[model samples]
Target: MAFGIAGTVAGSADAAEPRLMAALGNTVLTMTDIGPKHTQVSVNDKPVFEDKESDMLSFVGAYSLKDRWIALFQADTGAKDCPTRFRILEVGGPQPLVSYPFGSCSDAAQVTIDNDVLTISMPQPGGGGEAAWTYRNGKIGRTK
Candidate 1:
């Protein structure tokens, strides 16, 4: 596995855009380009998640909840039903906590943290309504 450091990737072009980063205590979380069209998430310079699909992945933000770090990412696939989706992941963890369709590719959403609650506000494509989620007991679930 090839690893890139900071602003440049090994044998890859200099990143055209800025990389997304967040600080969790002493650990650093980064979403950087592994190649021209690939993106990977690394914690303290170690690769945690790498998107191999053609869909473009963009880091939305990272937040701290109850002393745990979580990161959100947006994936754009250009599909008809759900062209765009959001991925929730625990920082330094290997898997996503949640992956849900937000809406079209151009749709916008906001993620906010209050105390220990994680709230996501966005337009529902099919007409369900707004959505909210919370992380408790080390698991992520929709607020009922």
Candidate 2:
């Protein structure tokens, strides 16, 4: 269905407040920046997961017909060797079912999961080039 966290959940401005939240069908993913390096992700108004990260410069997410979620973000920190990190989190579970790391993260902005194949286009830490992965046999494996 509709993706992206541009829309603020209405009737919630007076509530605790949400920095950004995206909806896919009946499931909702809410993110609140706890600090410069910490973020909390919640579903159905209940906080479920918390992650430590560098300053997030960009974030995007998408959902599949099975209600599985894929969240991608670029984490830029104050380091030369490890300046950024591309973090991916799979949602709709008690915890992340699948996780992947790319480069210091992706300098580009494209992440998609069609069916069970996940194609990610991002540079590696030392120039490894774009990579691909697929979710089959209940595991995530690099394809390219």
Candidate 3:
């Protein structure tokens, strides 16, 4: 009996370099790297999230003023029903501070720093549409 080696699926390999961002305290850090396996994430040189099962396209836009918050947008380039999601990660913490789901795609995101607050903006489905999010005291809230 002969066995066949499964070839790499389209868009499965990492095609971009890892972008590093400084986090709060200067000890914690965040990065987004595209590799042969898939898109990978790291915190302070430690591996965090790895998706090798499928082709993942991700973009990291901006960080909070204090560097405690990070905004990441990700999508499956190969999945038909792949939905774009915004993840707010807290450096050196378990899980993300918030995960917001959106139907529209986001090529970029921005974070606004206010007094003791962080605001995130994501593009909406229609043109010139956007969704705003606020993070404060470890809580996530939506603004119109």
Candidate 4:
């Protein structure tokens, strides 16, 4: 996937609508207005993923796979114990490839990607260690 112009997604063309979060090729990711102060992830003008009862969407990160783009997002409810959802989505796909009920919203800061491995440092109640997943050749799986 190529970003091509790159700036158009974050440029003035999308200034009139919801803020475009990221883009690669024709697949555009945006945080769209859902209701009063609520937003969700929209891909190619379609609402693809939204946290249940979540009021805010936080972009964790995005990675460029060999053939596609994978992104991580958090839907936060602003509660201390509420499990912040860690959503992984393939750009332009129908839905999230995986959604893990991770730790608190603050844990979203621990998510990262290296090469093709996506890792999350889990706090207590999340198995108390690091969980990893791998994306390669258009496939996703738990990294062994």
Give the number of the best model, judged by TM-score. 1
What lDDT does each candidate get? Answer: 0.64, 0.59, 0.56, 0.59
Model 3 CA lDDT for position 108:
55
Best model number under lDDT: 1
Residues forming the 10-long window of minimal summed lDDT in candidate 3: 1-10
TM for every model, in the order presented, reads 0.66, 0.65, 0.53, 0.61
Q: Which stretches of candidate 3 lie over 4 Å from their true place?
A: 1-24, 28-37, 52-59, 66-84, 92-104
Model 4: lDDT equals 0.59
Pairs that collide, model 4: none
On the 0 to 100 scale, the lDDT of residue 61 in model 1 is 74
lDDT of 4 at 40: 62
Candidate ranking (TM-score, best to worst): 1, 2, 4, 3
How much does candidate 2 score in TM-score? 0.65
* Count of steric clashes across candidates, in order: 0, 4, 1, 0
Off by over 4 Å in 1: 1-18, 92-106
